[model samples]
Target: MESSSELADIKMVLAALMQGMNDTKGKAQVVEPKQEKPSAESEGVEGEEDVDIVQHETNAEEDKGDEGGLATYMKMHQDFYASLHYTRVQEMCKQKNIQYFRKDMGAWELARLDLQEYKDMLKGGKP
Candidate 1:
C-alpha cells in the first residue's frame, strides 16, 4: 500500500498537470481571436479596377508626349531642343490644354504664333 504522503504528492502533481493544460487551452482561445484571414479587397485581387485606374493615370502621363503640338516641337527639336522634364512640361501642357506629341508639328507651329505675339507685345510692339 502507498504511504499517505506519497499519495498526496501524486495528487498534487496530477493537479498541477491539469492546471497547466487548462492554462494552455485558455491561451489558445485568446490567440484564436487574433488569427483572422485578410479580406479579399485587402489582398488586392478584388481591387483590380482600382489598380487598373492607377495604372491608367500613370500611363497617361507617359502617353501625353505622343499626342499634340509639344510632340511636334519635340520632334523638330529632337536633336537640339532644350530637355523639358516630363512633369513640368506635362503640367504646362495640362494647364493650357496643349496637346503633347512626339513628332507632329502643325499644332505647335500655330501655337508658336501666340508665343511670338506675346513676346512682341512684351517688347512694346503691338501683338
Candidate 2:
C-alpha cells in the first residue's frame, strides 16, 4: 500500500546505502596496504633492499619458532655430542660402579649422568 513517491525515496535510500558500503570497502582496502603482512608464500622480489628486509623478517620468525621444545632437543643433542667428555664419564662410571655402554650412547647416556657429576666431568674432574 506504499505510494509511488515513497517507493522512489526507498530506492534512493537503498542506492545511497550501497554506494556508502562500496566506498567504505574501498577505503578499507586502501588503508590495509599501509601495514604489511608476511606470508610463507613466494614473494615478489623487486631488488636487494626489499629482499634483505623480507629475509630478515623470515629469519626473525624462524628464531621465534626455534624457541620450541624441538629446538631445545636439537641443541641438547648437538651439545651432548660435541661437548660430551667420554673419558671422564667412563672413569666416573667406573668410580661410581655405573653401567658402561659404549656406542649405545645419546639421549639415554646424557640423561643417565648426574648434573653435578656432568659439570664436574666438564671441568675435567678426576675420578
Candidate 3:
C-alpha cells in the first residue's frame, strides 16, 4: 500500500494542474476579438453613392466624346441602348441613322431623352 503523505502530494499536484488550466481559460476569456482592416473595394459608399459615381463618370466621358461630333454621340447612345437590351430602339436608331446629343447630360436627363426617342420610334417618326 502507498503512504498517506504520497497520496497527499498526488492530490496537491492534481489540484495545481486543474488550477493552472482554469487560469489559462480565464485569460482566454479576457482576450479581445481581432479587428479586420477595410479593403479598397469596400471603402466606398454602400449602394446609391456607388451608382451615382459610376453614372457621373460615364456621363463625363460621354460628354467629352460628344464634343467631337454628333456621329460619335449617336454611336455612344446606340451602344448604351444595346447594352440595356433595347433591341427595337437599337434597330430603329441604326435604320434611321438618327443624330443624338450627349453633351452635359446627367443620368436622369439621358434616361428621359432615351425614353422620348423610344416613344417617337414607336409612333413611326424620327427622334
The per-prediction CA RMSD against the true structure, in angstroms, equals 21.6, 17.5, 19.8
| Model 2: colliding residue pairs | none
With a 3 Å backbone cut-off (N, CA, C), the pairs that clash in candidate 3 are none
Candidate 1 residues 1-127, lDDT tens each? 5799899999999999897774654465444457768787569765454445354345676567655344554445433222555555555555666676642232343346455554566568544
Best candidate per TM-score, number?
2
TM-scores, in order shown?
Answer: 0.23, 0.26, 0.18
The CA lDDT at 55 in model 2 is 48
lDDT of 3 by residue, 1-127 (tens): 4688899999999999887774654465566878888678787744534344354335777677655355454557645654553454544444555443432233224545665575567568645
Point to the candidate with the largest lDDT: 2
Better of 1 and 2 by TM-score: 2
What TM-score does prediction 1 earn? 0.23
Model 1 alpha-carbon drift over 4 Å, by segment:
1-81, 103-114, 119-127
Report residue 99 deviation for candidate 2 (angstroms): 3.2
How badly does each model clash, as a count of residue pairs?
5, 0, 0
**Best of the two (2, 3) by TM-score:** 2
- Per-residue error (Å), model 1, residue 1: 89
- Give the Cα-based TM-score of candidate 3 against the true structure: 0.18
State each model's CA lDDT, in order: 0.55, 0.58, 0.56
Off by over 4 Å in 2: 1-51, 57-70, 92-98, 103-108, 111-127
